[model samples]
Target chain A: MIEILLSFSQATGIYSFMNSPWGWPVAESIHFFGLCLLVGTVGLFDLRMMGFAKEISLADLHRLVPAGVAGYSLNVVTGIMFLSTAPDQYIYNPAVQSKFFFMLIAGINMVFFYATTANEVKSGDAISRVLFRAKAIAAISLACWCAVIICGRLITYYRPPYHWCLWC
Target chain B: MPGSKLGLLKLETLARLEETALSTWMRESGFAFFSALTVHSLAMAFVVGINFAIALRLVGFAPRLEIAALSRFYSLHWYAAVFIFISGMALLLAYPAKALTNPVFYLKLAALTLGLLISRHFQATFFDRPKVTNDRRTINLAYVSVLLWVVTLTAGRFLAYTHNTLLASRYF
Candidate 1:
């Protein structure tokens, strides 16, 4: 199984990426920029939710949410590029696996926010006391994103020794 | 013994530190060390990025902020931090001995630890304070938090060159 996985990893389509001079560094730089934008947009919004700026309209603050979304989207596109170039390295890697899962959880957590809090938020009641669910969603979202970063960091450590694990 | 030859040799004697079993395993597994290195560095943006947001808010970069409104982005920031940390650990595992012996690595860890502690304290104290105004204490903490992250990241970057245990005989 390891042999097959290694073979696949060394295959032409994937290996071509490593051969490309601009490929690796470009992916890296873009990933970093995306991270910064994501952090700038979403991180600021999260700080707002945590009561940093009471005078700022929540409605107005929502404007930054798309930037966070854009960051996530950019990461996804660049991330896919890296993954396509090195599928086995990431697929079998435990860190990558956990990152994928946490990312999924983070995504669902976002949906939950939109589903449960969108209405109240839209009504301008998001800052009120009855918004317990929204708060809960916020807390969960923070935790999930943290988990995603941790898992993503560990991906290099968790690569499966061989591709045969794919069958399992 | 104070003036012994070995004492003089201590300055010149360089002991090799070999790569650990885990690191060797990672290298053999075909992961590109260069790519992993870049990713690990990139992950910091997430960790420090969200942190900077929170810190800046505390320091008055954005006034009149709402805790409720901030919670949304905070969650995503947490996600980004966690992803970065996990990847960092993996990179560390890829070179455990080097990292373990590197003073810079320990420095980064200590800074991160302190930064988190202070951040949590700020959240508990100020996030729910009666007013949204930025107090001196909050501003101080914000500055300190940013300093810690910056130091931590710089130290992390320097670890590659400062490692005293890379390719040492212990693991080789």
Candidate 2:
């Protein structure tokens, strides 16, 4: 795993850029802005699915999903850049590992949501059954995303236990 | 006295607050500080996230959605705001000098205040005045609200990076 990460980092040229005075700070700022966009849109949609804002049509609320996707895309790009810059810092960090775990759960939950619950809600078939399913999925989505954010913040506090070998 | 008269007064007040048992406990207790940080971050996400949804609606992203329907979220927004405010105060008490001395801190506070005001103003406008159309003015306010949130979040993040003083005693 370390060897793969080392090779990947070597292949990328973002290190020098990330090491620049403005690069990391600017990237961090963008990362946070993207976080707000993602959480705000996606989280609100999940709340709606869970029957928070019942007055707003599910279809209309789903329209905001695209903005959430954009935010997620921005974070993924920035996240990869950060990894490319310093693979060792994240690869061996427990917090990063947990963050990835939560993200994977969120991704799977999202797929499940779109496959079953979203369709059920959109088609207006078996409203009660779909509402129950949607509520469960929404709860899971919210929990996973919140966990992801918490773990992401914890990364800075928990570093890799081992010393870095640049040539490893 | 070398600085502004108000600066001295503020420093003295902060110093006294820092010596209080509550402040000391908030600072020295590991769990308390960590919990407060977590609450602050989570609350920020909710407040910013809910506000973003409303702002996006106002910007005409979801024209089918009624403004009145979206107003249902304002209560959630306010709830999160209250949590953020309480957690934020705990954090400030923990390190009053760190935040009080930073310009970015003031910027974050200003942005938050303005963002909340804009949100309240628009909510009232949308709910109270039934005839107000989703015109350019409404959209403009939405744009401004989002901008202010961006500023507020950025400023809050920069506070960690930009602080030069951790306590009033050391600096003053």
Candidate 3:
């Protein structure tokens, strides 16, 4: 699977663009901005779900989630650019793998939130059972996202000792 | 002392700060610098993230949301800001000359100051109100705040690429 992904990335022309003087730095800036958007909107919504700001209606808070989703989309685009530019750096790095793992967990947590707890909270009155579940999902989502950030930061520190392949 | 003289003296003091034991420890200690960097990045996410949410709300991204209610995040923002400030200081102390000499460093500081001021202004004008009026001025302030925060993040990132000197006392 890694081999296939590596080959697919190397086949793209983004490598030269990414290797350009301004490419990486510009992408990094956008990546950080996207992170702020994701964490700010989605994370705030999660906090509300966990009963942090009870006065605000959950429906109102949910309005911010689309912005968070937009941030996630931005990151996905930049992240693919990064991966295509240097597939080996990410493919072989344990830190990147860990980041993917955390992202997967966060994705699952999101699904759980939407599928199960979202409706209960949307009613604007958090019953005890729904509140407990919401709190648990919220905590998990926060932790997973935090781990994803930490692991992403650690990727450079844990670069794989491998030569770059032109076409994999 | 004249203004320029005072500036030189302050730079001299900052240069000396690099030679302090704490600064030396921060630089030489294994993992300490890295840990501080991690903390700084994480805290930054929270600070920038919450601020972005607030900015979006002000600009009418979520029209149904009450601006006053969003002020609940003010405490979290401050907490993250405090964390970022301390960790950032550790980073600066570790290489005072590197940051102090870099033009980008000053830009980052300036941007951060402007961002903070905008944040305070938001708190006073919008958050403190019982009902936030989504006027043009409020939206403009929100737009400016978001732009300043993005500038702060970009300048901060560029600091790594733009610094020329590692230690001011030895070089200067």
Q: What Cα-based lDDT does every candidate model obtain? A: 0.62, 0.82, 0.82
Docking class of 1: incorrect
- Sort every candidate by DockQ, greatest first: 2, 3, 1
Q: Is candidate 1 or candidate 2 better by TM-score?
A: 2
> Which structure is stronger by DockQ: 1 or 3?
3
lDDT of residue B38 for candidate 3: 84
Candidate 3 has which clashing residue pairs, if any?
none
* Weakest ten-residue segment in model 2 chain A by summed lDDT: A159-168
- Between candidates 1 and 2, name the one with more favorable DockQ: 2
lDDT of 2 at A54: 76
**How far does residue B118 in candidate 3 sit from its true spot (Å)?**
0.8
TM-score of chain B of each: 0.72, 0.88, 0.85
The better candidate by DockQ, 2 or 3, is: 2
TM-score of chain B of 1: 0.72
Give the winner by DockQ: 2
The runs of at least 3 residues in candidate 2 whose Cα sits more than 4 Å from the true structure, single-residue gaps closed, are A1-13, A162-168, B1-12, B128-132, B168-172
RMSD of each: 9.3, 3.8, 4.5
Error in Å for residue A157 of model 1 = 1.0
Docking class of 3: medium
RMSD of 3: 4.5
lDDT string for model 3 (B1-172, tens) is 3159876786678668877888888887747777888888889898889889988888778888888888878878888899999999998888887888788898889888888888887777766575658789878888988998899988887787777766533210
